[model samples]
Structure formats: structure tokens, C-alpha cells
Target: MSPRRDDVIVIGAGLSGLMAARELEAAGRSVRVLEARDRVGGRTWTRSLRGHPIDLGGQWVGPTQDRVLALARELGIETYEQFDRGRKVMELGGQRSTYRGLLPWVGLGGLAELGLRVGQLELMARRIPLRAPAERADASALDGQTVRAWLDRRVRNPKARAVLRIATEMVFAGEPEDLSLLFFLFYMHSGGGFVRLTSIRGGAQAQRLKGGAQGLSRRMAEALATPVEHGQAVHAVLQEPEGVVVHAGNRSLRARHAIVAVPPALAAEIDLGPARSERRRRAEQGMPMGSVVKCIVVYPRPFWREAGLSGESISDGEPIRATFDGCSPDLSFCALVAFVIGGSAGGFGARPSEERRALVVEHLVRLFGAEAAEPVAYEDQDWSQEAWSRGCYVGLMRPGVLAEVGNVLREPAGRVRFAGTETAARWCGYFDGALRAGERAAQEVLEAMRAEVPGDV
Candidate 1:
């Protein structure tokens, strides 16, 4: 039989690919979505834990992320504020403290230093262009230095440095030594600012969808004319002057254009024909996903709330680095969501599941008391173990890589285009970024189609 044909073939049924398909369909184009995994939502996944819904992947939607928020509203998905009602915990250098407001119990001097550093980052980030950071005059200087080196020069207090390190892990899921200063600045600029990227009250993690983060993608998939085809891992993409053919196992799909919406590293694995640019290949090879293990522990009730604690914490010691309250609306069940990130995640994720759970419980016991020792259920998603995902959160850029090949991030190779959170200019590495990138890719294909077929527009 001849290959199935469509106006466009979207490889990967994640948020980015689904958004692209949605846009193409709205523009009177036929679309086919192929996904490697047996599910949708990409990095955003929602799973049940002890009869309670828990987001095992990307879950938070901030206030400044208007695109995703608008999409959620359009899909009739309701969102609720993240639980931040009581005091937050801070554990640094083997000492734990509780504070009612945003700033933790860092010393007055440390707070002042942190404020100064943030101000500097905000000012510098604003000056750097989000789309083309390599073109900036100071790009070479900034890109040459890692975030760790930059922090060393600016921050003198140990507590302040630790806080920034934890912030870097939480945001990028990578160590400061592994990230470029220019890339970090560009990321902050893309997401609005440092404050917006890290805040919960009115920031990037301000609200979460009622059902889960995956609801947005699921709803989008439901509205599409073509249902998503899962378990079809694409192996190669062949683009010619007339059309493109995507090969998955024994099956093949032909289309006028194609969108490769998987992570950059995963995209590199696909066998795109000879038209693929060396720059694009090198860029993808250099961009690797950050490591993280998302852990959700469910309890019968919100035990910490009775102690006047918010369940939000930043810790320097243990298998987990951060914690937040993930209780469902109406207080049906209480869950504590924690992140094991960076090198710690690598070590912890390697151990037996029971051992990892014990460590998490032990750590929580220290923070929230003996009540935290027992839970109804314990679950975690080790992104590194996922065959399709390899890693979580988003991809990261090392020193000098962004400056050398960042310009080719969104450029199309022959008839094959790219779309993912990594390709977005605004809100890069977030749900909003994924949607924006997908829409942009769809627009590119639509414009090309119009040009190819006069009067189509």
C-alpha cells in the first residue's frame, strides 16, 4: 500500500506537536500526529497515587505564562492557587528555620547580597535579546563563563550562594557549573525576570490546573480532527523537493511538511536525510536534558498545616532538594511533592525504590516532624529512567555552546521544521513556551504552503 498522506505530519504528540497540529487544522490543513510513547502530554504527566491525582511531570503554570493560561481557559480547565498559606521551611548548613514570607531565614547580610545579585541579573537579562543572545556585544564574555563562576564573583556569603545554587537546580535541574551565564540570563529574560521565574504568589508556579497539567494537552488532543497515534516511534525522516516521508518501524507517513517537536537531544537520534544541517546536528548534540526525579508522597491529611507550615521548603542536605504542598482542592487528600535534582537525583535515582522512599520520608520527618514518617503512598518519576524522555524539566546549554550554534535552534532543515519548549523565545522550558513554539512552527508551515500553492490563503 502507498504511504498515508496529510498536509503536515507532526512527529511527537507532546504539547508542542499537538499545538502545531491544532493550528494547522484550524488553518484548513490536514495533520497526522505520531508519538513514540503510548501517551500524550510529553513532560507533563498526571498519575494517580493512592486514589489521589498527582502530577509526576511538569505541573506548575505561572501567572506570566499567558499563552498556557489562556489555553487552559479555552479548554475549560480550571486552575487553583498553589498552597502557600503558612510559613515556609529553609534548611541550610544543617540548620532549619521557618519564615512566614517569601525570603527565607537567610541572614540580613545574605538577604541583601541576594537582592543585589538578583537586581544585577534582572538588569543584565533585560538587555540580552531572547531570540539571539549570541549577537549581543557581551555575548562572548558572558557565554564563556558558567553560572557558578559568575556567582563566585558576585556573591560572597555562603548562604546566599547556596540559595542561588538551589534556585538554579530548581529552575534548570542542573548544576550552576554546567550552565552558561549568557544562557541563564537569556532564560531569565525569556521567562520575564528572575523574580517571575522563581516566585509562587504571582510567578511561574502560581497556579496549577484542577485535573493536572496533562489536562491541557489531553483537551487539545480531544479537539483535534485526527486522534494521536501512539507507540509509533519515528526512526527516520526523508525530505524531498515535493514532500517528506516519516518512517516508523515498517510504516511510513508522507506529508507536504513535517514538525519534529521532541527534545533537541532526542531529535538528534532521528535519521533525517542528507539535507539536515551540521549546525543543527551539533546544536542538538550539545543540548542535553536536565536530570530530575519528581517524588509525590500522599498522606491522609494535611499534617504540616496544623503546625503552621506551608510545606514549601528548600534544603541543602538530603535526597530531596525542594518540597511543596500538593493537596487537592476541597482538601480531599494531602500530598507533599518534592524534587530530587542535579547530582543528588542521579545518585538517588540509582538506588532501590524502597531506599529512595525511606530517604525522602526521613528527610521530611526532620522538616515536618514524626507525622511525616508515614504516608498512604509513595511514588516518583525518575526522568532518567524513562526511555522516551531520558531526562526532565527542559534541556540545558553548556558554556559557549549557545553562542556557537544557538542561531540555528528554530531553522528548518529542508521540509522538516522544529518545535518544542527549547525552541521558544519567550517562556522557554515551560508549557507556555511549548505552545508558542508549536504555533510558530505551524505558522511557518502554513505560510510556506500558501506560497507554494497560490490563492490557498
Candidate 2:
């Protein structure tokens, strides 16, 4: 039998879709959420690998994140502070250097401090819509330049440049060479920069999920009573006069409105009929996603603590981009997470899994010692492999793209609404942005529905 006609049909049960469904349901609207994957959390999933629950994707939350933190608080999900134990190690220009300060660079003592202050300034700058950042009007001044170029011009110290590159890669998911200076500046301003951004204290500040993010989504689904049909890949969307139809295999759903909660790259596949414009075509082509390869190697014990280092290392300009001491106090397990940004991750893609593990193990052994090489278990995720999510976070506009067509992908198209980390105004590419976009799209739909007039009983 055909299901009863619902008030709204939301596609993709990611953080955003769930949030939109929750809001719509709270307002007494009937809603159904559809997910392409067999799981509920979409991209944000956590599972027991080997033994520990290392987040496979979409980890970390911040206190400043009003939506996610509020949801966590409501669900009673607790968070733990990041375990930043010991001193950070630096590998630059083939020489290994150990630093005992807040930042990994030397002369950056002043520039890093300035960068912190600039991040604070950037947060305040968020008051101005990203569509028009004052500095952005002059594309030659900021837009045309890559983050690496901006940093190089600002910080004369090569070490400082390298440290900033690591931070940029972590945040933007791209190298300094490709990231826009205006984008980074706006990112800093929106969230108050590096220091304040890191201090969200359980919200942005901690990494514990209590049970992990997937649990939180389940609670949202239950509260909304929204049926999330999993393993159903939406092949096409056909808009009708009264409602829109979603197609996948032999199954199809018709709703008054459809939320395109999937990422831009994936959303490109959905045929919007005549509404699909060249702008979206360019967005699908121009926007970039990070080719990220994260390796989570857990040891029988926290051996790195004995190495007189913090277990965190930043490469000056090497393939071993960044490493951190992702260990708990019990010492039963130690996680060394290495982030390979831009072209750095390409080499590891074709390598065998065991070989990939061996490569990271060798890097750790070279810096921390042979003990670091031994692992009880290892887990890795290449987000690129995900058909649903082609890459991790949305790529920032390279030089020419942002200046010419900055808001092309963010605009709404007919009855189809877009949401995800990329559409958020504040934190455009973070998990927080994902939550923000979901909330914003939900509110937009709610207001629109409430304003609608009934046609028939």
C-alpha cells in the first residue's frame, strides 16, 4: 500500500535533514526523512573498530555551536577535552625540531599572536554577510591570493609558515596554495580565531560523544517520529505542481517540498528538470572536497608519552603533514592521527591497506621511536571513497571562482532547498556549519510552510 501523504519529505538524514525534520515536526507538521545509506547518521558515523569507538567521520563539537551543543545538552551527550599532553614535535625541511609552546613555529611568537587576534577580528566580521566581505570587494587584494601566499607574505619565518599551513589544512581541508585569504580571514572572524575557536569546552572544546554523534541523530529521529528509509539512493527528483517526486529504483515519494540536504557534489546528480541552471553546473564543477586520508593507530600503551614529546607533530612541508596525541589517561590505548592535505594524500590512495598502515607507522617511528611503530590496531577512512560524500568538507573558492561566483551554490532553486556544512554563513565547512545549515534551512521551510494557504481539505 502507498504510504499516507506526508506534509514534507526530507532527503538525506544527515545532521541538517534531522534538524529540519525535528523543527518541522515540532511545529506540528508531518515529515518523513529519507537516507541513501543503510545507516542513520549519514556522514557522521561512529563504530567499534578493532575495539575502540573512533569516529569514522564528522567528529568534534564546540560550545559556541548553539544548535549542536543545545542538541547534545538535550540528549545528555557529554564531551571530553582534547588530550593535548606533552610538547609538540615539528618536522620541517628534513630536520626534526621540538617546540614547547602553544604554536609549533619559532618567530611566529608575534605573528601567531597576531593571527589569534585576527581570528577574533574575523568573528566580529561575521556580522557582514560573506556575500560581501569588505576586503573581498577588491579581489586582487585578498580573493585572488591563496592562503599560503597571504601567510608567506605576513610571516617571514619558514617554520611559522609551515605551522599555519597545518592549521589551514585542518580547517579548510585544502592547502594554502588553493585557499582564499578572504575565506580564511572570514573563518577566523566568524568563530573568533584559533585560540577562542579551540576553547569551545566540550562544544568546540572537547571530543567525547558519550556514545558518539550517531546516537544524537537517533534521538532526533525518534523525537520527530520521522521514517528514515535507508539504502535508498535517490536517482532523480521530478518537481510537480502540487509537490515534488523523489525517485530511487522502483520506489518513489511525492512531497510538497524536498530538501536537498546532501553535499553540493552529490546534489549535482539530482535532475532538477528546467530549474537546474548553469550556475549549479559550475558549482558542481568548481567547488572542491578534500581528499583526506586519516589514520587512527592505537597502541597497547601510551608509549609516545615516554618520548618526551606531546605526540603532536607538524611537517614543515612534507607528506607527514600533521600528527596528534589522541590518547586517553588510562594508557590502555593511544591514537596517533596523521592528516595528509592536498596532494599529500594521493600517494596513499593506491597503496594497500597494510602498506598504508606501514607507511604511517614508519613516519611515527622515525619521530617518536620504534615503540610508536607498534600498534594494537589501526583504522583509516578515505572520505573520497564515500559515494554519498565525495570528500570530507567543501573546498574553498580558489582564486577566480569566489570572485566571480561566490554565492552560486548557496541559492535556493524552486521547491528544492539546499543544506549542509557548505551553505552555513558562519563556519562554512565544519561540522558546526553542517548543524547551522540544517537549522537555517529548517527555519526557512518552516516559515514558508506556515505562510502557505490551504487549497483543499
Candidate 3:
């Protein structure tokens, strides 16, 4: 069957692309989705490792993330909460404090409370818009300062700082030193603040398709009655007087509109006809990729649980940095995921996979006793090294970027609209951001199609 021509061509089969295609298809418009990877889900990839489904790519969706939750529900996918079992351990100043029988803030109760107050204050600060918020008036105060700086001044407890640091690391996948406080604030605001974050149940908290995240994309494509052409890496996107032509391998696809949903850094490489605007260029220029190394270690068993440990640990030391009990609840499998971000992750990303695995093993053994060293399997995804990804995710404004060029990313460039975690107006670096961006881009395309006019070039 000749690829069914469409009114719009949705590039990338990631969540954003799939969502865009679905939206266009629902509007009585034919659509074709071109995916570069052989499988669906793009950045959200789940693979079988050690005879179990392991999501090595995008993982976890909060409850308040309406776009993703709505899509998951639409597809009949279910999510579970991440495990917060056992006692959490914290390592500070070369001292390991194991909370054998205590609350989460046992080690730093006062500081934890203080940090909550500061967090509440920061949350209030974010409600003000970047364009009109008083915070923006003092934007210069935060521009050059990193999350570390802001937290240090605002939060007195070292343990509290560590917790917040972990949150920042997981969310941005980079050092807080590289991300803007304003951008971070906006992120919290977008989700309606800390009170709203939710995870899948059983410490298995993440809305996973009954089959897998990949199944969600597959089902979405089926619902659209569109065959997603996989392994079709888009090379060039050219504009014609009548429509747009997309070159993917040897095949050329034409459509009245095209939604460019790849990473901003990657999307910027594709040449657009009529050229992109200064604002778009600024957005693209300001939009840089950040790095994060998600290392997964499959344990022979939940040894940490046996040790009266929560499988959650924070370190001011080496190797593992932080460890989480990523195992699915039923105790069927045990997974320990460690995140190395920014400059720290860079070193790990550059190292050979085997060496990196060894380093992780050493760290796990030290933190969780010797049992952690005997892993059934070990794997790591250096998202920065993945050519298609360039980096794990998009970078937040370094001080000046967002103040001067941030809004550009939120703006559309001609017939070419952008979608991805990076382009999200809400949560720019999380799975939620991808969902929001995809849904918003779909709405943008629908609105443009309705007007019977191409969107601003």
C-alpha cells in the first residue's frame, strides 16, 4: 500500500509525534507518522532484560500530568506507585546514617521542616508569570544563580539540600548548577506545586501499558488507522508552494503541514523552507541538550530490603551517588537505578559500557553491603551518546538563555511546529513536559488546520 498521504506529516513516533498524528487523524485529516527508530515510544523505550520488562528510557509519570494520564487512560494503561519501603539512608560528611526504624526525615527533622517552608515560599514565587511576576522583576537575582545557590541561601539544612538536589537531578537530569532557578520554579508551578506529584503504585508507580509503553504507541497508531513507518530517519524537510516534503531515507512524504517532534537540538538540524524566524532561531539556539546516565542493575534478590533498608540512599561520596529501589512490588524482580547527571554523567557517558557497569557495581556493593555486587544483570543507557537523542534531555536556561530566548521555544515556527519535553511550556524536562507539548502541538495544528491557513512561519 502506497503510504497513505496525509494532510499533515507527524515526524518522530515518540509520544509527541504519536499524539500529534492521533489529533490530526481525529479531525478528519489523513496522517502519516515517520519514526526513525525501529520501535515505537521514541524516548520512552521499554525492553526485556533478565526476562522482565525494564523501562530504560522515559520512566515515571506524576498523577497531575493531565496530558500523559489522559492518554494512558484513553489507551487503557495502568500505573503503579514507586516503592518507598524500608528505611532511607543518607551519607553526609563520610558518615552513613541508616534510619533503621524512623521516619523519612528522621536524620534531619528540623531542616526538613525548614526546607518545606522554603519550598512553600519558592512555590509562591513561581505563581507569578515570567512576563509579569515579581520574581521576574528579581529575575536577575536568580539568573546566574544555580538551584544549589538558591537552595543554600533559602534552605539551611544540609540534608534538606540533598533531598532537593536529588529532585532537581531527577527532574532536569543535570546538575542544579547548570539550570536556572526561574525555569525550575516555572516547572513546579506548571504542575501546581509539590502537593501534586504522584507516582505509580507499589513502588512500581508508573502508568505502563498492559503490554509496555511501546504498546501504547502501537495502539495509538492503530486507532488512527495509520501505519507508522518505522526506521525512517527524517533527513531533510523542504517546503513547496503547495505543501511540505519530508525526506526519510529513499522515500519522500508530502503533507500540507508537518509537526517536528524530535529533540530541539536534533530538530534544529533539519532545514526548513522560508526559513525559521529570529525567535525560532533563538529558541533553537537556546535549546541545548542536557546529559543524564540512567544505570539499571538487576539484583539476584532484594538484598537491600533484607538489610532493613528502604533501597533509597543519598551520598555525598562516589560512584552510585543515589540509589532507588526500582523493583516491581511483587518481589518478582529487583532493579536499582542510579542517575549520574551533568558533568558528572559526562565522565560516565564517555567511559566504555563495561567499565561503567563495573563502577556501578562497586558502588552498589559499598552502599548495600556485598550482596549488591552479585547482580543478575547490569545495563546503562548513556542518553548523551545516543546520536538520535544527542543528550538525555533538553537543557534549562543557563541564566541568560531563558530570560532572553526562552519564550522562543514556546512559539511556533511557520508550518513547522515543535513538540517534545524541551518545547513544553509547563514541565520542560520531564515526561509530563513531553505529554503537554505533544497535546499542545496537536491543538496548535488542529487550530491551524481549522483556520484553513498555515500557522506563522
Return the TM-score for candidate 3, rounded to 2 decimals.
0.87
Q: Pick the candidate with the highest TM-score.
A: 1
What tens digits encode model 2's per-residue C-alpha lDDT throughout 44-88? 788776556777676667656666777888888876666665777
Backbone clashes, each candidate: 1, 13, 15
Per-residue lDDT of 176-250 in model 1, one digit per residue for the tens?
A: 998999989999999999888888888888988988889888999999998999998998999878899899888
Question: Whole-model lDDT for model 2 versus the true structure?
Answer: 0.70
Q: Runs in model 2 with CA error above 4 Å?
A: 1-3, 107-128, 131-136, 139-141, 196-205, 454-457
What is the alpha-carbon lDDT for the whole of candidate 1? 0.90
lDDT of 3 by residue, 273-357 (tens): 5557765666566656778788889987888888788787766566556777878767787888887776778887788888898
The models' CA-based lDDT, in order, is 0.90, 0.70, 0.70
Off by over 4 Å in 3: 1-5, 99-117, 130-136, 152-163, 194-211, 453-457
lDDT of 3 at 131: 40
